[model samples]
Target: MTMQTRVNPEVRPGTPHQMGAHFDGEGTNFAVFSAHGTRVDLCLFTPDGETETARVPLPERSGDTWHGYVPGLAPGTLYGFRVDGPYTPDRGHRFNPNKLLLDPYTREMAGGFIRHRALYGYKVGNAGADMSYDGQDSAPYVPKSVISDPETFPLDATRLRRDWSETLIYEAHVKGATMRHPDVPKEARGTYDGMASDAMLDHLTRLGVTAVELLPVHALKSEDALLSRSLVNYWGYNTVGFFAPEPRYFGPEGVAGFRRMVDRFHAAGIEVLLDVVYNHSAEGDHLGPTLSFRGLDNASYYRLAAGEPRYYVNDTGTGNTLNVSHPQVLRLVMDSLRFWVQAMGVDGFRFDLATTVAREAHGFDRSGGFLDALRQDPVLAGVKLIAEPWDIGPGGYQLGQFPPEFAEWNDKYRDTVRRFWRRDRHAAQDLGSALLGTAELFDKRGRRAWSSVNYAASHDGYTLADCAAYTERHNHANGEGNRDGHHANYSENFGVEGRTDDPAILAARQQRVRNLLATVFVSQGVPMILCGDEGGNTQDGNNNAYCQDNPTTWIDWDRMDEGLIAFTAACSALRRAHPVLRQTTFLHGAERTADGLRDVEWLDFDHRPADWSDPALGRICLHLRGSGESATGNASTDEVFLAFNNTPEAAILTLPKQGKGLWQHEIDTARDAQASVSVEGTQVEVAPHSLCVFVCAGETP
Candidate 1:
């Protein structure tokens, strides 16, 4: 029996310090937690993911944890578990030794997922369904979690210190960002090492981006349903191990390679913010595979039906929701987060479907343990905390409900801005509110203007090119018959459906792209530009290209749209230059003697009060004068005037004539040539669907 030993429960506390896994670098003591298992067997496997070496039962059980000390076993040991118990699904006990389980605390996973019937716990044929047990060994197919050494990385080796406010996040994918790069070595392409190379860092530095918000780097598996439909989950929203980086991104190497990549990013001034998927796991539903969590303690880890423990409460729309309300489950998440922040040296996190993380018995509590823990954490609190603040659950549309410290992905700002520039009727008034950080939604709290993270395009939706080329989502590439992505895109093709040779159509599209980008950066929130938006990257109208690992989604670095590239560079420069555009506080209304004009005053063509209800007033000028002389306090000193025109035809506006300083052109996105026009006078012409910003002459603003 492989020199087996057993220690019963009801002895000691289930703490890390008390676990048998704590050894003094001589050997590893194995400890696996299982709240409801009668027998927990630690199954060892070969390094090649082929043969099973041994199966040893954990000797000690304390509180709810099962553990045992092994003399020879160390860091490179490939191991999994087979918790022996009843195969009763109705009571939420789906334990079968036939199915191999990954450790929840696994620091590294080795192989990619191979779809096979052996990976599932129950028998293939289905009269008894999951209730029926199978005796077939699944050791040949499933990945074995490795035992990690706490001192694997030196303490001072890989950590980065990046402040939250100084953060400029560049959201990208580990695969897609480097999959087709010509400069990256062929063997290293589409890997973590490729993304962390000096070339990648140089590109980021040139763009002046601070942090790289990587799409889910967690270990993941494609759902059986999506696999059946011939599709893949490229965005990796489905997570398997919270503590492990996807082995694929590690390339052919493994955990050692990933550690090297983190070290490289720190060497540069860049930080890594992982996009985490804690709401749900890759195991879809009760019908899904008996992976780590479901097989171990299904009833405790997941939210089960009121009467039927076998059936899960599908709050995540992925068929199973993790019960973070449970104390142990909550601790698991906290532990995983701390491991990444402290060990991996990740600067921050962008929570995918974060609303699900905050859900409890009452509602989506902002004060839930997950949110509260992260908020109170000394390390996590200093890093950027961004939330995609919605899920497919009830009350899931929590756009601005996150705590003041977090920056939320503002879909409303993106949608409203898209609709407004698309010339949709009745969208003009709301544009002002969105531009001002949606005070109607995020104002009342102690939240600063950065609370709303605005974007015209992101990974989930249409690219900037598609937003100007497709009226509806053409997601047929996802292989779900174009039914996967969102339908109401609020996009408008200028004059053609896809790419066109017509100069008029192309010109209009380019101008619209600039207009959209300008609006996002100039808006009163932290603006996020989609990875390839700078160069007019297109998905061929596939709004949800989540499955495409091919070049269809990879950035075309060589063939960048010159005009779009130049415009994006200019836009970024303008945002960094002007503090008036990205202020901490909301701009108050018109006041007296402030540059002999109101701090901000609305105007029409005739320089008169803009009619709030006037349908004809598609154009308006917002004259903004900043009160702060320096970065420290608020005092009206710097003067900035913005002329905005949404009309098809240009409108003339009377500029604010004061301050003896001539207006210096900062940015204008109307001309065919990507150039700025500096002219100061009582009257100025505003181009159609274009915005222009001017700074005072002889002033470095």
Candidate 2:
């Protein structure tokens, strides 16, 4: 079963074109990039990868790449790189030949990362800090890269390539979404195979989500600080290997399990999108351990400070920022993206801390090198590209600044919708803008309504259930004294904090959750629903549960709210049934020449034109008509009317008159059922802190 060959294979000069270990039937070629290293050695290991068997120096060097070939070595060969270079931390060169470095282009990894003092390049308690070099061999503590053949696991499923206008994204974690499912096999739970099981597929298909945006699946290492506290980076923001999939999520078939999962998802008509974190690595600050990147030409791989090279430019809140501006680093990212699409069969990507990748020396740029490369890439241009759009660096919040090719996560929409439901002052005006795709911010640059990815709750914040049941964050379990997450959550506790048994308070909380879900589905954008939000899942008010991998973060399938799930499904079906709701064109209240009807209309409670300057207004009505220039090509003459009331008192709203059609009640957040009564009068009373929807019935006006 083992693929290990003789202890010492015949070595030959290999070409430097390929970056990583490539198996070409007869032998395997090993290549790695190291700009400042004087020598590069390829270390071969046993089948278990616990001990080194041979060390052969690369016989050739072309430009910055060192390469060599072994005549008899085949796939599954365990190997790693050791580069010899200057060890000057102050000048930003932290290469140590003693440390075993992982190949940046590794497709699979062997063994596991063992935390030890030998992993660090410098002595633990030396007075010179990183300047003092340590000569300990780290092969026993580090993982070895495995030579893999892509042809072994071929992906034949066709890409779904769902259009942006019709996408309803369900953000989920690979393990959290499947770990608690009762029907999944015991051994498959929390693995890639579990996500593709029949139970999971049925749940997602029944919910009507077009795509599932998975959290990071890239290989990562937990921080030393979190390991000391018995916690981990559950969200996977800390990436260690871009090419290798996380070994922890692998099923019985290893890397092939990921391919099968993607194929199954595609067969079920659900696209898969990965949330990628290319901004930084798992290595921490200047006092951090010398991982792969730090040990292999640190000055070329990372962005060092201008005058003081000992420290790194903390553009990302993480310890070191990747120098994506560098040509080789940029190539590494692009290669990884293409490999995922062509070999792995992913439909799209969601970039975390995206601003850090698009930033130049000056500041965040829409046409920066990284963004420009993506814009012109033949393989990437057609795929879905989304950006988190912000970081903690100087001038990092670059919302609505990306090119037309990319959609952005709109935090403005989230805040506005939350504040409106919480009855914040002047929130009505902003709420209207949010429902209209925030045209003031994204209408320019030829961007369509789908460019705004609207969501009320995401992974980094409180869940929708917690947003209605708790005002203060209960993150004491995160071990940060509850000071880690956002303080102003724009949430309301109804009557009591955390959980309450009061019937009235519980009713209020349920209504608020329904209202929020309704708002997201009816809005003109690509809507994203947080996983388990539809089932009324809560993290015990732990808004910053990034490190909790227990029941607190996992979705409890047995305790789901069935009524809320049905309501969420109904909202999604409504959006899919109406083309006017998911238009690619932005509506600006402009009259359509085809029917002489305005695309959108705003009104007050008395059916008069809404006063834009009214700060005390808590009620607003929207009338949406199909645009003649709708890009979907299925736009009909049908119309929709929405009424939102955040005040403490009920209001009588007048419905717009249609010539030959009558309005039918479609949705009411105050109740669970789809109220399908035909309107008999022009005036309808809307309850306080609720929303109502009416659709045109019979004929067109």
Candidate 3:
């Protein structure tokens, strides 16, 4: 006879003393950590969403954790908790029993939300204040918390270590990326497996990028406004579950399909990084419906107003900011990151609006628990961490202010480079700062040059083509009466707006694209090129295309411009070949001679020393003499020199004398012609908005 123990409800305090749901093999152990709760009840629901099976009272208490376990309850069971705590508004406790809650550890959820007045725990028609209680059934409208099968989950591991300096990140949307791809099977399209297909992998390898940064793969829900407007949140910024992958992105096999994709990416020597949003959720403000964290532990998970606990602090400019200062909330974030890298076999993570994740009582701290835990964690320390280091919070514009362990998206580099090539006044100084890895911003402590992730056009704004062809954001299709998106685009339309038949405008746009590509590749930082920037994909000037999941967001592989593709390939190849372009260490102004010449030299219009105070100059040349350091820390660096002309008029650049060995023209963005050998010590004429890189052989000094 096998012995069976009859389990009862046990309540106790968890870490940080909020609440937690832990799963054992036979049954799930549920615990909640509300400090002021007078009573706690665990509500069990049926699998089909109709019946209320049981209302068991939590029995045991240990510190702040209130725990209970049903001996027969297994994985896939639906459960929630109702807490009865102080209704104090000024003291920050808003626990009510009428609302249905979601388990924090829930791994899977089904169906869409049914919006109703019953979703809120407070009375909707309270004459004086919202403090009045309302007796309503929120179970029919609220989403149920699903217990996950831990046994079926994949093992989380930190593998595939790619160096940050050598890393090339490719940002992609999981669903929209493969939704219309011709080669992907119909069933697999818009799924993780489709992105993991041979067709996608082949394209990534051929493009020479090392990492693929996915745009928000976590489980998310469409906003109520979007649902009513017949639009959708295609970008998945409104996170529903940080621990679970959006099930729709997985194929017929569900979770296993995502695992397979991670395995394939690892096998192909390509790393996968998720763009995670920890700032806000689909649950909005006081008027918003009760969701997972709101009903279960609203006061713990959200940063509510000082005098009114129900009113939330909107730091993300979305709706509400997560209360990251709370210990349980911090644990949730770290746990989610670990699960992805371990269970999914992913390589790294790019945190979207990461500033919100690091906010403490004082302000955004570099040593905040979330950032500190990631830096100290053995699993996460080895993986890459990229931060979009800003939000709508006070003093949230932290570009290079992140800890030394992470890389930040440098919007300064983006804007400055754009203004320089677009022929804006006094842009030379700004361009010089960006090209030199923005030493003013990032040359601190012992951080390397790669700390800055330089990109001209990313997924958020106008594409590379549109950057040179649209002055204002054209977003009429967004249905906001053309009153959405940014006005200060800093983009020049060359000659005309939208598509034009003028050959000169078309030619200038293509050349400017090359110019921007050349600047990114040659700049002393990690360059991230957009997916379709190489072939000039346009969104018809829609800068804010987050909701546009149609052909506007898809990578148009059919109508690719062959000439631009060749030019982009050439630029990437040049960047890969030269060590000076992607140096891990910052260069000093003091001249250091190696291999018979200074490692780097700044050349003026006459090929002399550049004048720092010069106000009228529009073009300058950068003379990089190789230090013979190993290229990308592998092979010996080849001696090379480059000339850049940003002025509208063509300029004659005097080449450094080359004697015993011939100088090979490696890449010349000024012309479509292939590279050729240069005549000895001859003056190389560079076209307007053009650059050239030449390689030469020389003995060590």
Candidate 4:
């Protein structure tokens, strides 16, 4: 193919108020931020994104922003930036005009990043290391930012503002969740259109999840290491473009596919939450590729070491941490967030490695610029904001330290639930704290119970089935010699390691999975179900399947566990049906004025007050009633009883007789179905290694 210049369009000084390629119907304005750049050239490419049509210099620079206007450029025009400045790495001015840079606010991307030697600003295997600058054109290897008009993909303004207490989150991956669905169209599978397909919507609706927290959907590039091993970044956490959706998930409708999916989710009464990666860019460390941020303004975009500007602050464990404390960088993040909500129609965001973004000069600040900005933003404050709350850096675990507007993923809940079910010593006390929404961690700031987003398993770890079927992580497929994932996974295999035909072991594993799911739903917090856990999805013990893009991470619909699915739906329905299960107020065993009953009563197997100090006690029960002081205006008058037995022997549990109605059995983890039979007496048998739920049948006191 011959490289030819199709048009030498007239370039004039444009306004730098907007930070990306914006189309005003007749023409397009291009603007980019590069604090230390001496010159910026807007490289426009052909329709196929193969040939470079023109390189128009941005005629003006206003306050670190370079901008230019093209009279004939339209919304579909493909463009990138080539910035020229000092190539010194030690002083943090690694500006190389040879490398094509992506606009930090690009709404849509054309083509994908191809790992090539030219992509690196420094010469490979150079004796001088990063000091040796490579004079190679990287335009062919990088993705081009597309000129976009937000009005082109119009979305509904109506949002399903579901209450936190009533929200049931289902965390899923865009491709992994829909790739293998039989009902999704063959061509649409693994795309946004497929996820919003009738079959997927029906499944989500049936599961009773109010919100779908999707894995990172931002445009990302596979790392060179993974590519060398014939693997890819399946999780999409290595973000290259913060504003654009992953082009791989776009169907024939292109960027509009994401908007259509969100619209469909809203129509089905489900909110869409994105797992965003604002903590870092895809560009790794000093030796990593010069993809976007590094080539544009290395010092302004990344938090370089104070004394060693060449080395990056690896707080995210992804080589480089984003300098969110900087005013311009902060603006970029805020703008990206608003664009997603205002243009893409997403309900909220789950910030990945949240602590890194909120870190300041000293350490992780509870009132950091990024956090305070989100809390004060008019568009973001009303929407749901969740935080992973931890990073690999020092003082990273700030689980409950986020502001009141944010909900946090409770890893303590996950570990405690797993350890308690596995019968680990001294876990019963922790289990008590977890079931009540870990009040010790989150209750300090007058935060509600729903602030703790509870989950037994998440995308980063083993699946619910794998938790019961594997004793240790088998992440050998990740090419790290089984050392890539977490070592202490709190998992067990019952008797066998992998697959087995033994009915007893299979039954036990199924019961354990049910117990974990039940615990999540029955707990007084927002429940987040790992997508395929309800249907017994396993990764063959590959806990960290972030690199395995094949069936190892994809949900296999063919092997769907029908009974488990029914049980999961029943658990979600039970939580939804009873307001007592989803309490907005933190129950601290306080007395309720409505019925003269305690909001929560911990009981022993013998129905007496629970011996909470006993380390050997593994069986316990909870009596839950709606709180009179509940933040939710309409307090529930219903009562619920939950019995958990992790011991080898069954426990005879006696129910409280504080209510006037008979107790009806609602859930039994030992069995696959809901036992809707009314209890004849106050005493019931709780099967070993199982959980049971009973509700007040007729009337309250």
Candidate 5:
């Protein structure tokens, strides 16, 4: 039964207690925070969201919030806001009453925002630019915010609260993951329904990823430049509305589709983490279009320059930065996060350019208000909070500086693992530090090893296939003169640059793939993988395919490297089965007991004690066995030894002795698919640029 009341004209002044459009069964309350607005008009839309039906002025103002109640409006009602305030741009105010702004707290937005010149606050070709006024109606070309009672979904967020130590994040785009899959119905392809299908759920469950960190699904504005180039924002980093889910990813039932998607993921014992961009909105720089935040309260919502109020602080390098310093702006962010978790059923969030979120007046304060609020928030403190941890601003490469509540995306681990697998000199030290969870960075402040979220590949960089098959970033299709992505990719092609016909090069590239996969899974800390990297996804060496939404970015399910996929699966299974690999506490050099074997022992290729400072050594031999408390409070696990060979030729590695039990080899990157591990006498020959794993029972190496 519909829980909405019939439409009527019994309008009343409402309290400014809550933000956004909230329907309370009898009436709908509309509230928005605009600190500098003189007047706020609530523009109601037709059923099709095309024509403006009525314009009601909000009659109450408490603090910076403008609020009112439309006594008979129901949950399905569509609306937008137009706030009247100062129009001058020199002093950091860009308000235009003609342009309808989206409610920052809008739960569901109707997408089909037709790009038109009238949507801009300033006239298109006027020399006076932003100074000139435009009186055109923007309702004809913009999306309308919908009134939604987010209490429509089931509230069972108890089961999905996975600890950081057990999280295996699978970073993927909603459309790119299952758009071409044969099992997903043709009509449901690339929609939220498709991602929630049995095939997608089965794949994630079988692959053993505990969580799926989806690329941005928030409603965003397609950049005009990319539109002119006939490309869309595949990454969805250009966010316009935080609370609203992207319409393109939805099916016939609108918000219900996303709700079902999250429900299904949780049902499969997998968590869902959204890649959110709250640092800035879709509004571009000085010459950018005036969207929601820019048109509503630019001076309050954005961080204007202290010296020059008209200019913005370009900390995010995304043209503008959200001023989280403002109380109302901070409230918007906190409310948005809580809404996504409690109302929308998402388990966690991965903040993109997260350093910008914690920035204060002095610049990048660890104890900033944003982090302080998040730490104290009961709803958010328990969920997974991950940060990209860096931006393009000055002093923005903050790797291990986040609060204890958050786990940072470890790029150092990615680079060091790549260099170690590629046999760079002096890489053993870096690899060893990463394999131990970067104790120097995270061991302080009562943080655990899981604070460093390790990964070999991510969505922003080259896939594992590209990392082994291409040295240079071939991003020619990004329409930016092949200069859009990173230049130093830490990638290498064995004998060919892109693709080759040589069997030896192909074999070598496959070995490198297995090596990288084994590195992430075998190393400590939470491991993340790019979605199709397990299936050999490639963008023709395109490291940055942010704008290419076609096959260049989509995962080609048919062309998967079956052998590499099997290897990755085995690695994931090994990581899950062996508690010794996923350690919660730091590995001390001491043994588990006084006279027992060590928890972790470092050795050279000759089975001797390792000289960590030696620059000539490039191999990593680590024997790991846990006896202390882990993340789950249980420890005693199997003893496992891992050997990584980074040299140019085979090396004879001396083996540790056991009473009567033999060391059973588990993995060798040099071996073929499903290769049996035959016992080699007393010494094992490790091939060049490969990794090997052997399970031992009461052994010392």
Candidate 6:
């Protein structure tokens, strides 16, 4: 490799205070952290990033970082790093000057990885394995990072920051949400613009979702194993660049397209929440290819095993866990989060495998450094914080275990709701606890019921529409011979496994879906709905479709279940309108006042108190009073009563005389979107296998 045609771009010593490629109007200042690297070269590529035109070494070494300033570099300048150091495997240094490495803080990139043998640092198919070094030039296959000036982007000033108690989250993939949307323009489909189009916004706004919790948007690359199968990592969990938005999701305007999408969502009064995966990065462990973090500073960026430097701490189920215990590594995660909130105009983040972020040298700690840092951070603490609350590490199932500042995805809520709807014996007790926001689990430490982020379906599991349609997972299309997905679904099919022409079976399945939706919306917590589940989105029982990026993951707008969609919207509206449904305080069976009814009371046969110990119990009623704001915050006082029956025989529900207002039927899962008149009397017959929601002082439209 000769540099005979290289041109001087007026390079100078650069500051290492900022940790990314920041381009001012005059030039770009490049800075990267590499505690153990001996030398770092900044390789500049041509406009198209196909050829390297020049190689400039960073002239400054501040502390452990290497930096340089180019006098005439532009914001879109394409470049990558080649840090020269010892290629030691046992000591956890995989740096190779031959391979081009991306900056961990890059905001945009020009290309993606092309499958080539030279991308890997170690020689392939050699007996020496990772212990052997290969000096093949990987500039042609690896992408170059684009220099983007964060100060140049203008964020919308009207971004919405909804209260966590009132927050209703819609978990969606940007591509799958609009790819099959017929009303969205053909060219705009699957792009950021399509998600912000009138068709998408109108639907989301009408549904009354306070925020759209988008799946991973961090720039990622497909796994080598997947690439071998001609498949891609559709979920984007394998993050290659933390700051850059995924290049595939961008429109012709590039990074600007993502900003526009956020602006439009904010304009519609809907918050944007990003499902971030910071526990790990795209660069896998010892045998994986040397990418951004691995190539730049493997030992500093990753959590190598205490005794074995060549191995990694696989706490994230990925190849390696990010070493957030390291201050610099922690800074990268925090900086990326702030960039999304301040620069990208996102409102919050739902951290994937959040337990790892708080994992220290020993175990998960509530007062861990990362958690404490967020608690003290002025920028990060004010925004909404949601955690997946668990990882593949030991003692990782931490539902309802996060600090008071965070709302956690309550798998207990998910499982109990599914079991109750499926009429599992002895599920009534767990159902009652879940309906009251699992207070037994999360009520202490000043945390409210809203700390539970409740949902029945998510992107990683079977869709809501498929929950009652198939008993077993059908993930053959995922190319894993159907062995990749979960084995125990806790799901049930009425009679047939996949599809049936029997009207009775179909109606039963539909009612079950409605039942689950009712439970989620009315429960005392922050409700989250899987994006397309409201429209009866089905993945054909593919519980784990993280790799299938085709129509299987995309929302089928043409054949959408309109009835279920309308029902879901109605449920969302009711939840938004009624304060009793979303309680900041845990629900107990005590009256709000001396004369008023209970904040939440369970009723059995003939208005008798529920016998929770009854093993065969299949029916119950939740009488919720107009308890407002937990005697703390300011909110509305609205009353509601929900009756659910899983029995085959109809039960006559006696509505209590609350002495507040008249009772009216707002929802009946047995009927199709009907508004019944306000009942003058107290008695109402609840059909078998159905859910009923009644409101006070209500009239039929």
RMSD each, Å = 3.4, 2.3, 4.2, 1.8, 3.3, 2.2
Those runs of model 6 whose alpha carbons end farther than 4 Å from true positions after fitting are 1-4, 150-158, 593-596, 628-637, 658-660, 698-701
Arrange candidates by TM-score, highest first: which order? 4, 2, 6, 5, 1, 3
Model 1, span 1-701: residue lDDT tens: 12223432222222344322433475566666678888988777667767676776777777787876666566877778888877788988888876788888887776667778777777766886777777767666667787777766433434566644345667899888887778887778789988887677877776667778899988889887678877778888888888888877777555667767777887778788888988889887888887788778887889888888878888888889999888878888887877787777877789888999899887799988888888898756577789999998889899989998888999999898898888777677778788778877887678887888888899998999899999978877677788888788888887789989999898888888888988887777787888888788898899888888778889888876876777776777767776777777666664634244455666666777666686544776666666434545445556667677888887777776664657767778786445555675667777888887776664423
Per-residue error (Å), model 1, residue 188: 2.3
TM-score of each: 0.93, 0.97, 0.91, 0.97, 0.95, 0.96
Off by over 4 Å in 2: 1-7, 153-157, 629-635
Provide the lowest-lDDT 10-residue window in model 5: 1-10
What is the C-alpha lDDT profile of model 2 across 87-180, one tens digit per residue? 8898899889988989888988987778888889999888977788988888888888998875853434357899988899999998898789
> What order do you get sorting by lDDT, best first?
4, 2, 6, 5, 1, 3
> What would the TM-score be for candidate 1 when compared with the true structure?
0.93
Clashes of 6: 0
Whose lDDT is higher: candidate 3's or candidate 4's? 4
Q: Distance from true position, residue 692, model 3, in Å?
A: 2.2
CA lDDT of each prediction against the hidden true structure: 0.77, 0.88, 0.76, 0.89, 0.84, 0.86
Counting only residues 3 or more apart in sequence or on different chains, how many pairs clash (N, Cα, C under 3 Å) in candidate 2?
0
Best by lDDT: 4
- lDDT computed for candidate 5: 0.84
Instruction: Write the residue-wise lDDT of candidate 6 on 1-701 in tens digits.
Output: 23438565777997998998987788999999999888999988878887787887899999888999998788778899999998998998888999999999988888889888788899988996888898898888888898886555543333576887788899999999999999998887888888889999999988888899999999998898887877899988999888889989876556788888988998888899999999998878777888788888999999999988989999998899998989999889888888888788888889999999889988999998888888888777568899999999988888888899988999888989999888888888898898888999899899978899899989988898899899999988778888897776668889889778899989988888899998999899999999888978888889999999999899999888888888988898888888888878887776655445467778874788998888767888888876634455543346788888889999898987746468878889887675656876889888998989998774334
Model 3 TM: 0.91
Better of 2 and 3 by TM-score: 2
Candidate 5 local lDDT, 139-251, one digit each (tens): 77888898886466434445388877777999999899988888888777788888878988888787898999999999998888899888888889999888888988876
